[model samples]
Target chain A: DVKVTQSSRYLVKRTGEKVFLECVQDMDHENMFWYRQDPGLGLRLIYFSYDVKMKEKGDIPEGYSVSREKKERFSLILESASTNQTSMYLCASSFHSLNQPQHFGDGTRLSIL
Target chain B: AQSVTQPDIHITVSEGASLELRCNYSYGATPYLFWYVQSPGQGLQLLLKYFSGDTLVQGIKGFEAEFKRSQSSFNLRKPSVHWSDAAEYFCAVDQAGTALIFGKGTTLSVSS
Candidate 1:
């Protein structure tokens, strides 16, 4: 089975702090994505990387950025964490195809104070 | 713009009852549709997907969804509901080679 692992399941940070959420996928998939899930907004994509060092903005990309330094690792960075940025973060990886489904991590629930 | 819509925000049904969740989409051409389930505090799980050919697709956990081109809808259905079936369901459409566009989601509640 494919496993997408998030570094932190639960995290707490103060406002204006720089937060880093890490994700690693064992399936060697070429596509990785970062999304923030809110109560009514469902899952809004923050950023997605089709390959290492390549990133593209999604529907909601403000105040957030991502890095794909290696094939297996993808990182989501919060430049300045705020109370509004606190939400459940999900990481997913796919096999670089349109028909392929994305495999998701357990998710990181971040809380900003 | 291409988008996905899940009409029901929440639905409650008794155990052993038939269940159906509605999903509609707006796009220029035939779209790739998918149904995902998220258990409490977990990430989304792929319940089923519709690419082409077959209109009715069977998925894991006794869940299935049908793609109707005329209605532009792909609704999820199950013959019987279980307690463990309570979860949030999301319908998504492919964004023409980019990431998927997901709906707001429907929270399913199963009663005794």
Candidate 2:
């Protein structure tokens, strides 16, 4: 079975603090994604990387940035955490194709105080 | 740009009852459609996807969705509702590449 592992399941950070959310996939997928899910807003893509060291901005990528140093690992970075950024963050990975389905991590619920 | 819409924000049904969740899409051409489920504090799981072929597609956990080209809708259905099936369901459209546009999602509640 394919597994997408997230570093943290829950996290709390203070305002103005830098935060990192890590995701690792064991399926050797070439595509990794970061998304923030909010109530009523649904899941909005923040960033996605098709290959190592390659990244693309998604619909809502203002306060967020991503790093993909390795094909199996992707990280989401919050330069300065704020209360408004508190939400559920999800990481997903998929084969490098348009028709492939993305496999997701369990998710990390981040709260910025 | 392709978009998805899950009209029902919430739905409630008793155990063993039939279930249906409506989803609509807006795209210039025939786009890839998908349905996913997310339990509380969990990531979304792919329930089913419609790329081509038969309009009706069966998925995991006894869930199925039918794509209606005329209505531009892909509605999920289940013959019998289970308590464990209560979760948030999202409809999504893939224009190209791996990026997916998702709907707000519909929360399903199952009661005894």
What TM-scores result for chain A when each predicted structure is judged separately against the true chain A? 0.98, 0.98
lDDT of 1 at B2: 89
Candidate 1 structure quality by residue, lDDT tens digits, A37-96: 999899999999999999999889999988899999999999999999989999999888
- Runs in model 2 deviating more than 4 A are none
TM-score of each: 0.98, 0.98
* lDDT for predicted candidate 2 compared with the true structure: 0.93
Recovered fraction of real interface contacts per model: 0.65, 0.80
Give the clash total for candidate 1.
Answer: 0
State the TM-score, rounded to 2 decimals, of chain A in model 2.
0.98
User: How does each model score on lDDT?
Assistant: 0.94, 0.93
Total clashing pairs for each candidate: 0, 0
Interface quality of candidate 1 as DockQ: 0.78
The superposed Cα distance between candidate 2 and the true structure at residue B49, in angstroms, equals 1.1
**For every model in order, what is the iRMS?**
1.0, 0.9
**How close to the true structure is residue A71 of candidate 1, measured as C-alpha lDDT?**
97
